[model samples]
Target chain A: MASNLPVPVAESGDIDLVLRQVLQDVLGLSSERVAELDAESGLFGHLPELDSMAVAGLLTEIEDRLDILIEDDEVDGEMLETFGGLITFLSDKRSDA
Target chain B: MPMAALAGNWPNPPHADEYAVSFDSGRAVRLLIVPALFDEANKLRHFTVEVMRALDRAGIDAMLPDLPGTNESCEELAGQSLPSWHAAMEAAARHFRATHLLTMRGGAICAPTGLPCLRYAPVSGVKLLRTLLRAQVVSDREAGRDTSREQLLENGREDGLALAGYSLSPEMVRQLEDAELAAQDLPDIAQSELGGPGLWLRAEPDHDAAQTVALARIVAERLA
Candidate 1:
């Protein structure tokens, strides 16, 4: 719901911060490791930790935390390309809701 | 940590013995453990086993049953639907004369209704399927074959499709899409407060032995 919709940002801020906490918990990463990551941080192709299997688990966690339903046709490289991209997509989803 | 007592069938409903087992007989057993499905099942098995052992030690009898077509059972998964699984759990409870249930993750949605069960880390089946369906989409897209939700659902319905390495029936997918582990399904079902993070979410499936012991103790105390 747009009720809690956060304002847009130039770089990963709120969504990234929230998502990073989820990443740390869901992926079993230390807070320091997730906190070290930023908007420009590359994922999927870059992070060996984010493999196909891991991605599925991550998506499930994201949905659980964010309460967003990611559609089949909605998935693509751009959305999962970087930390910023995922945050932006999530932000948009919240706004639309 | 208690030893895994044994893996054998108990007799009451003769057909149920073909699929389930409990360590104790008659009124000694009080709980039936329905584990999470697929890979989560593999990761959660060790944790579940330890909990069962602790429960046994705490004077609460817990039974773990293999769903038809999974683990040692040779039955095909093609026809195994959610209701069938529920029926199986019900039969096992009846066979063991169990008074309560303890379920983990996906099993939360499959537990027999009206029983006083404890659900730990119950995840919505619809949310889980969305994750798997997205994986299919991404995999297909990478393969140069883009697909839509309708297209994927149709294909899944027509032919049994595998998700997260486990082959699933189309009917199972449909039922799962509708299944929820919300309060409505289990009004009186109490939620177990388990410590530690969800192991199923880790990139490499890791086990937390201490967490398992703590969880087992909590479960044992709660049922006491």
Candidate 2:
């Protein structure tokens, strides 16, 4: 009893790129700034653009774009701490999907 | 954009003027625009306007109405709840005589069950509130303080919680959190099949002529 073909998960790089697009769109960030970000680039407290209001919009955009459900309690400061960490979490979530 | 004062004044100090917009086509068909809630409303304004105009160009009538206690509505957000917002949209639909509905994002929560609707990227209520809560936490961090959901809920219970610049009552949060909404059995969903990217998720608050045209075409072709 096979559960269809195993769903192909996105690579971490691809995940990072897509999440960056979502962040740019949701946070009204310039394409340049979004491009400037790297795995170690700070988020949350570090990036002023990643403020309270923007976080909500950013997460909602991520959910819609990624087709994933982010639970209320699952949100934490760590996932949003760095670009690399966020991408890792997203990659894992997509794999789980 | 013809405006109507659906609800008059807040606090009853003297007079209030809560207004709604109806983009009239004077044609037989009319659409009721239920906007995305909270800060999303501000971000989506350009797109919303573009959609309304596109509808007009397609010879379809449309109405863009502000919910009670929002956007020039003369009422306090502290008194607003999801049910009240739903009822306001329902009343506006009747007032505009809209045959079809066009809801985006959280607006789907207020969609009238019996009426046919065209939803664009419908988001559930819990997702919407979770975003709000995140925004609250971010704001707290900016103020050099860290806050949690438990504290937020406690404050909301007392009076109301200000999240992402919108004051929401505890009742509003409770009902919206409990709500699980989507465009079910709707005539259409404005998806890639409609030939456009999601306008709401675009990077800038600028106009997307291509997407708007595609949306107008979809609404006219499917709903008609």
Candidate 3:
């Protein structure tokens, strides 16, 4: 019932900003470090700070900020494999919402 | 510069030997800081202390108390529940003669009501529990254990659940599943207000000087 409630649609740029901020906030990466992360930049196993626990926090923070729900089933190594992959996944989710 | 010192023993009901970190200069504007719970607690410990230090510089006294089964308290985590934590916070408020409360994240749930409070990025109990459960699930997957969140919740309600190294009692888990922000309509400080991302979500313990100054100024101005 709560999920059925109307939610605001986030713009594409909003998703990009939210993702970048989540990475910086949850991973404690500096803004410069986050900016350096391009589409090909690896995440997950690449970043030492993005450990399992940090992954949980990161996902939760993203959901809270973007106002979109990320089900556990939707979470996989592919979506979190790179900066571009994550941005695409979130953008898709936002458009679908 | 104000120094960190231990407050006198608070006779917190069944627990009598609890300790708290206080920046006391006998100031009139006193604050009782209820920190984030569990893993977030570890991540935000330094940030919370820094906030307290900033408050000290603002000429206000604040105390960060050890809830039963947390921090320096000797109680077992498996035996503690939300009510127990709320009780401990109430006792701490009374013992410290606190005039206001500073609650962080999940700490907002157990904060003693009726006091003028400053809640920083208050989180729901369900979200907190989910974060812990997800962390456990991730860790288990890495170790090839393959546990689901639903399965973990079932087991948590039956017995105690071990989440991110914290053994939560069934009652605590059950209560947390239904928990939301308790102190409503109070002054809330969102992450944006601090002009940065939340430190509690950080991978490691970290602090920001801007956040410290912003939070201190907010509280000081509120009291002023």
Best by lDDT: 3
Q: Give DockQ for candidates 1 onward, in order.
A: 0.52, 0.37, 0.62
Which candidate would rank higher by DockQ, 2 or 3?
3
Give the higher-lDDT candidate: 1 or 3.
Answer: 3
Candidate 3 displacement at residue B188 in angstroms: 1.2
TM-score of candidate 3 versus the correct structure, residues matched by position: 0.90
Q: In candidate 1, which residue ranges exceed 4 Å CA deviation?
A: A1-12, A95-97, B1-4, B10-29, B182-192
lDDT tens digits, residue span B104-131, model 3: 8889999997798888888989989998
For every model in order, what is the iRMS?
Answer: 2.1, 3.6, 1.3
Q: How many clashing residue pairs, candidate 1?
A: 0
How would you encode candidate 1's per-residue C-alpha lDDT over A1-97 as one tens digit per residue? 3455356574336567778976776568777888888779897778777766677777767876777777766678888888888888888876776
The parts of candidate 3 lying over 4 Å away from their true place are: A1-13, B1-4, B183-185
Clashing pairs in 1: none
lDDT of 3 at B58: 89
Which predicted model would earn the best DockQ? 3
RMSD in angstroms, candidate 3?
Answer: 4.0
Total clashing residue pairs per candidate? 0, 3, 0
Colliding residue pairs in candidate 3: none
